[model samples]
Target: MLKSRLYELSLFLTAVAIAFSSSEILADNTSFITAIIVFWFFSTLYFRLRVFYKNGNTNIEYGISYDLSFVLFAGPLGLFILETIYRFTVYFYRKWKKIADPNEFFDTFYNIGTFVITNSFVYFLFQHFHSSFQSFPFGYWVLLFILVCISSYISGAIMVLLFGTIGESITFKEGIHFIFKDISFLDYGKVAITNGLLFLFLQEGKWEMIISLFILNYIVNLSFYSKSQSIQNKLERDQFEQMAYTDFLTGVFNRTFMDKKMEELNQTSEKIGIVVADIDKFKRINDSYNHAVGDKVIQHFAATLKGYLSEDDYLFRSGGEEFTLCLRKRDFSETADLINSILRGVEKNSVEVEYNGEKTSIFYTASFGLYFYKINELTSIEKAYIQADELMLQSKQRGKNQVSMVNGLITKELV
Candidate 1:
């Protein structure tokens, strides 16, 4: 945290210094500078061409600003002014919108600081290249292309540092991979071409044409940005829904989803098999090893059950060390066969857990109580669930690892 703050402060101070030192180069025509700043500010606000990617825990969101051309034309003073105005405007805009962002405050400073410093660096390079190469051997277009690529590379580095500020530690290899993952050479060429055109019109004092070109670019960018945002919103909704219904540790449907599903099933006149299964001597596992090992065992048990499920079957972690299986489109005999096979599979498989730096296989068993019945108006799913749970308790009382139903034990013994 301290390091991040220091880095931000350094960048901010350096940018301010550069802006102040270049005060002499303020454009003679104040109106041109004003127009540039206004366009740049609005472009940053409305035009965002963003690409999203996932690299492990890091979510890399890359936006193609294409503002480098204008920045180069504006110089240090203009760059700093534009960045400051845009950052502050965004900060206030979010506040007005009642958006609760934890990092918004730091982000405001970080963004302005980073952009000012980076663009100033790029501007310096542009100036150097322009002076050194009077008539470029490889042509000016190729030179612009190379500069844009270099700018992109630098931007990626700054993004990595931003991640570090937020406490996301990534390795150098991962950083490099992140930098190049979604970036296209074609996009870099687009940046070069656009900037070259903008620079040409600016030199010829064709402000109206420059405005037209910027408006065209903005329209194109807004279209793509809208599509990207829509896709991103849908993905976020799906992820949120999954998280709501899924057990955090076991990766199965949680009790909340089970209840909702049961309500839906009760509305139908279909026969469903409800199997309530509980790990035998589960409390002992937590006491003997640790909660971490206990969690491992639970995950392994859930995976084993999941492997046995067909398309018509659903498994849920209804309680701690307890799971519920709903078998649709299966008769009593078929359900019995499946449950018996699961019982045998549980006995055959063992979970490997680490204890005191030593790995050991822990063989365990589970008891199940199945209630096969057709959903009707007379019997509510809540009542049926209670009946299934009571039968599971009966299995627990009958000396642990066995399936008990209304008729009695399916098997004489399961060890």
Candidate 2:
């Protein structure tokens, strides 16, 4: 935290130094500087693209500002005027709205410093080559592209430095990847072309065209930004919903999702197999070992069951040691065969866990009860589930580790 504050302070001091050195140029081009600052304010207010970082829910937004174009037309003093006034204005506005925390003030200082320094350096770099290459064919556009690339690199380096100061140390390659992860080269190209055109128009005294270009660019960018925001919102909603409906330990659908699916299945006329599976002697496992071992055994058992399921099957961890599987697109015989195969699979598997500083393999088994029937108005999913549960309890009574199912009046048990 101290390092970040000091880094911000250094940037603030350097920007102040640059601003004072160019104070004399500010008065010489008052009208031009005012025009640039006005447009810079407008762009800063409305035209920004949000780039999301992969680390978490953090994002950085950048505007399609006229600052770079101002540097091209009116030099470093123009940038100093634009950034100093515009950023402070935003700072005060955020403060007035009760949104500016203590950190925001420091961020404002950092912004003023970095914008001035980076743009001033870019201005000098362009000027160094401007005179020699101005007469060449397409040299101006080429120079603009080069300027854009170098500025992007500088911006990325500054970001890496900021992360380092904040204790998020990253490799240069990772920093570059983070910078270009969401933003495309085409977006950068558009900025280069837009700023390049703005520069030419400012030179030719066609200020109305600049306003028109700003409006057009804002409209197009707003459309795309709205679309991107919609997609991001949808993704977040899906992730949240998935988390709410998932079992944390087993990574399967939980009881909440199971209830929802059961209601949907109740409304359908399809032949369904509601299978209730419970780990045999789960209490004994916890008593002999620990809850950690019990959880491991449950997870391994759920995984084995999942491996035997088809596309039309949905598995849910409906209780601590109980799971429910909804099986479809299979007849009675096929369902029995699948359940027996799952029983064999569970019997063959063992959960390996570290117990008392020693590697231990705990073998376990499960009992299953399958209620197969076509859904009708008279038969509800809750009723079917209760029937399956009763059959599963019967399996437990019949020495456990077996599947019990009823076909018509005959009750069959598979061990």
Candidate 3:
């Protein structure tokens, strides 16, 4: 999910680069450099998405990349002005300033708007300059270069703000500090290679350098992508293991594991109780709002039971609208109240969820048929289960939303 989002931001930048027709100066640095940068964004996005598919998630260098992109933008006049204002107030007149941090100033809506407007205008300016002044000398391009850098930083910083923290504490000095602090030779190699290729294309007018840079960037991104994918795959495998024992709807253990666990519990203890709990008239809920809402209710109820149960207590999905709990105990009567307490907590829960677009809330009551017994009384685990199951039916028959007991008499407590 995170990678998908990061990729989306890159795509947006690529579109903007295209919109301004920043790739017109085939004879100069503008066209090839613009193409390379756009490619970088797209390739990064592709790598991220690819990683997401092969693995689940990854830790990315958001701050480093954002700061790099911001440096690219900060070279422009817009951030220069903001930085000038920041430098003046924070550094020159540190005593008089209401906001002393450049980061705080950068995060303001005004700075954000300026960044956006200037970025757009700067791209428009580049398209105009590249088209109108493609033959302009390198000595005369310093002003435009500054503008483009600021635009790039604005675009990158805004992108960072969209996905990450941009706080008052994050200053230009801090950003520069981090640029070197976590310096990766890999990134330096990329920068060197990028500039080398661009210089070749511009200074030496070698068309082949463009292709070389493209390949180098792709190869570099691919290496990171493969490493990220391995991490993602590991995360997914762990998630699968978790889900195998968990309910998708309610985030609890599913019925299969619950039943198997009950058998294990029966083996160790002479006294054990199996409570098969079902939500009363559950179909009504699914019919009234939607299955999604019903699912939310189930999830909420399941979570409630899970929250209230002891570590030794185990719960699972028996089926739709049904749950099975293995109540392990040496004395059936002694543990009955504990189960009752958990039931009361479930009754008290209300589920809140969003379905389609609307928010919905629901509360449900459950019927519990608990089979209590000593391990030796029943023939095998299966027979012991059958006996307990029979008693549960008795409880269900007597009341739709109440606990029925076997091997010991117990009263239902309504909380």
Candidate 4:
């Protein structure tokens, strides 16, 4: 189902309203805590500029700003202010660099609402459980910290799932899967360790720990960014290599791939089988209908050929209306059955085309020529192709839809 832009906008506005309401209950305190929060927020922005990580459909940098806001402020109002500052800073930075994407403009509100709502609930739970932080044991403090992290993650995940489903028609299950997959253990560990360390520093009144932790966090973010970039580059290279060996129209192996496979086979001493086939009256189909309909017919024929191939077989779109199949470790009878099955499938299938608002169906068939031989050198493959091509011409001459087999270099016609 497609989602309307107006609906998405309405949802964003409603979320912003809720977050604003929640921020009204926060206690206003302007002191050293506020200054430290501001410093950490800007430091997060600086590290964010150095490393941008893609999570699901959005790019989000790992930062301690959210953790700092939740741990230091302990109030809804302060968390809201810190979240607003961080979001606007990132937004203006993108605008100044002329890299602002309008599609992502709504994310600022969504993220703010998520942080305010989740952290506010965590603070409420923390207050309910602990009578006073002064007398709380260290073990209890650690438990409370873990609870905050888990609850914050869950609440944020739910918000993301809700917004994603409303905006993009993504399923709840898919959203959950994406969220879990995107949040690596490293992300959780970084947040837990940094926030825990910062909490202890505040308790001990140690100001120097701030700079040390910031540098360490930045180095870790940089390392993750480099690893992700390397993986992305390798995937792109593999895609390009695949495209080079694939037929774009038919989605089958191309002539170049066939050549490479033949070369590989030449190095082995096993017997190989080759089948060359061409659609009967393919040019007539194009001339009568149109090139579009001809393409549909070709795609259907390719699918039919693919259905008859085994795991050890390879199919290639050798020409406009011609295909070549390579079969290994198959005897003459097995090869004949496979070739006959392909011919039968092609004859039974039909291609549907729409012309001038009306639908028409067309059926087509192909002629096959099979050659089997032992591969000793590259020339053996070349010779097999020549023999198969000649035998295919014989099948086309005998009839338009029959198999002509060259058994052990002996020409034989099979219907």
Per-candidate TM-scores read: 0.66, 0.87, 0.43, 0.72
Better structure of 2 and 3 per lDDT: 2
Q: Output the worst ten-in-a-row residue range by lDDT, candidate 4.
A: 1-10
* lDDT of all predictions: 0.78, 0.79, 0.54, 0.69
For model 3, the local distance difference test gives: 0.54
Maximum-TM-score candidate: 2
Write the residue-wise lDDT of candidate 4 on 172-264 in tens digits: 686666455455655555565666676556555455776566667667767876888799899999999899999999999999998998888
TM-score for candidate 1: 0.66
Q: Candidate 1 — which residues are off by over 4 angstroms? A: 1-31, 43-67, 71-145, 157-171, 178-181, 185-197, 204-209, 212-240, 267-271, 281-300, 329-334, 352-362, 373-400, 404-415
lDDT of 3 by residue, 1-415 (tens): 3443444445444444443343333333464345445434543343233321111122222311211222233223322333233323333343355434433332333332434355555545554565555465662254344444554455545444443332224556655543344435454444434543454454454546655655665677677777887998999998987878777777788866776666676566466676777787788988888886887777777776677567777788878877777666447766678668766777776777777697766767877777665555334445555555665566668876577777632422111
Alpha carbon deviation, residue 26, candidate 2 (Å): 8.4
After TM-score superposition, what is the CA distance of residue 42 in candidate 4 from its true location, in Å? 7.9
For 1-415, candidate 2 gives per-residue lDDT tens digits of 7888899889988877876776445324655765755576675666235343433211344655566787767667667767777777877887888876567777777877777787788788887898877899988777887777677667667767888888785887899886555557776678788989988887777868888888788788788889989999999999999999999999999999999999988889888788999999999999998999888998898888899998889999989999999988988888888998999889888889988999999888899998888776776777888889998999999999999986522333221
List where candidate 2 sits over 4 angstroms from the true fold. 19-30, 47-60, 131-138, 176-182, 407-415
Q: Lowest summed lDDT over 10 consecutive residues: which window, candidate 3?
A: 51-60
The deviation in Å at residue 413 for candidate 4 is 21
- The numbered model that scores best in lDDT is 2
Which ranking of candidates, highest lDDT first?
Answer: 2, 1, 4, 3
Between candidates 2 and 3, which one is better according to TM-score?
2
Residue-by-residue lDDT tens digits, candidate 1, 1-415: 6776777677788778988887544355675575566556555656235554654344444655545665666678777777777777777776788882655676677777777777777778877787665576856777778877877777678778767765787888988976665667888887788878887776676788877877787788888888878998999999999999999998999999998998888889887778899999999999999999999999999999999999878999999999999887877888889899999999899999899999999999999998777776776766667778888899999987899875222322211
Superposed Cα deviation of residue 129, candidate 1 (Å): 8.2
Question: Candidate 3: misplaced stretches above 4 Å?
Answer: 1-238, 353-361, 376-379, 408-415
Model 2 RMSD in Å is: 3.8
